[model samples]
Target: MPLPDGNNFIEKFAKSFYNLFDTPATIIKEKIVAPNQKTYPWYHQKFRRVPTIDQCYTDDPICVFEADMQYRRDRQVDSEILSILRQRFEDCVLYETPDHMEKCKHLLQQYEEGSTDWFTKYGDLGAYHDVKVAYMKQKHRMVWERRHGPVGSGMKEN
Candidate 1:
């Protein structure tokens, strides 16, 4: 069905805006996963710990996996996808999993340029990757400074 007059503008705008956010990553995925793998590398288009059967996406092929093992226990963000990603990096620089944009730069640089030293600077723990992602997670989680007030809601103390 066709939208009529001004009513259609909102609907059209919404579709366009959604595309603007989802397009860049998908386009890059197509480029990087082509030839051997040519499908979306996204599972549900939302933040998830593991990719589902439906995602059918190949992991990023550019980064080289590491053989040495490094493990830490306190962190809860350590999903299998994260470990798999760890193996994909030469220096084990898998800062953000499930798509983390670098502040405002490439919006899709993935690893921190040639090195994974970014982890030493800012280890991941549901931190903001960019404005868009921050907005989305904040919108979804309604980020609070603490559970009741003081702390303990996965927030830092200060």
Candidate 2:
């Protein structure tokens, strides 16, 4: 049925305002997902799927920030190792191959066996413990800089 004609200016204004803001029942119904009473593949049902990285970008800001930080940290660690290796070996070409893979395997074995003479066995390319300590210090500095707007910025460390 058609709405009754407004009797006065106040009624007309009220009707107009209600019409502007009121949502149709059909539209609200369309938004609601009714639970499936029967298990059927053809029926419309809400299915939960794992969120992709693109979805995470908009959905979780903290997760995205943490992932970016981890990526940067890993890149810095790799760069440090490469820089040290290049400084020690002038003509060394670092590439992954079966031989290199075997060398890594052997190194891991030696490390697990409590051998600390890796530099003697594999040339003077610095100790693994020293490299790890340096990486951790660098990473700590990067995190501190990010949180406190860089060192020497008049921000006293506490």
TM-score of model 2 relative to the true fold? 0.23
lDDT against true structure, model 1: 0.41
Give candidate 2 regions above 4 Å deviation: 1-57, 91-158
TM-score to true structure, per model: 0.19, 0.23
Prediction 2 global C-alpha lDDT: 0.49
Name the runs in model 1 displaced over 4 angstroms: 1-7, 36-158
What is the C-alpha lDDT profile of model 1 across 1-158, one tens digit per residue? 87676588778899889999899988887777565663567763333233222232335322111100111211223444345444555232255543443332342233334124334322443443432332343344433533434223455546
Deviation of model 2 at 42, angstroms = 58
lDDT of each: 0.41, 0.49
RMSD values, in order shown: 23.4, 21.0
Candidate with best TM-score: 2
Give the per-residue lDDT of model 2 (tens digit) for 7-115: 6788889987787767565455556534423455775553333432233555676655555454445445555565554443332224434355554554444343322
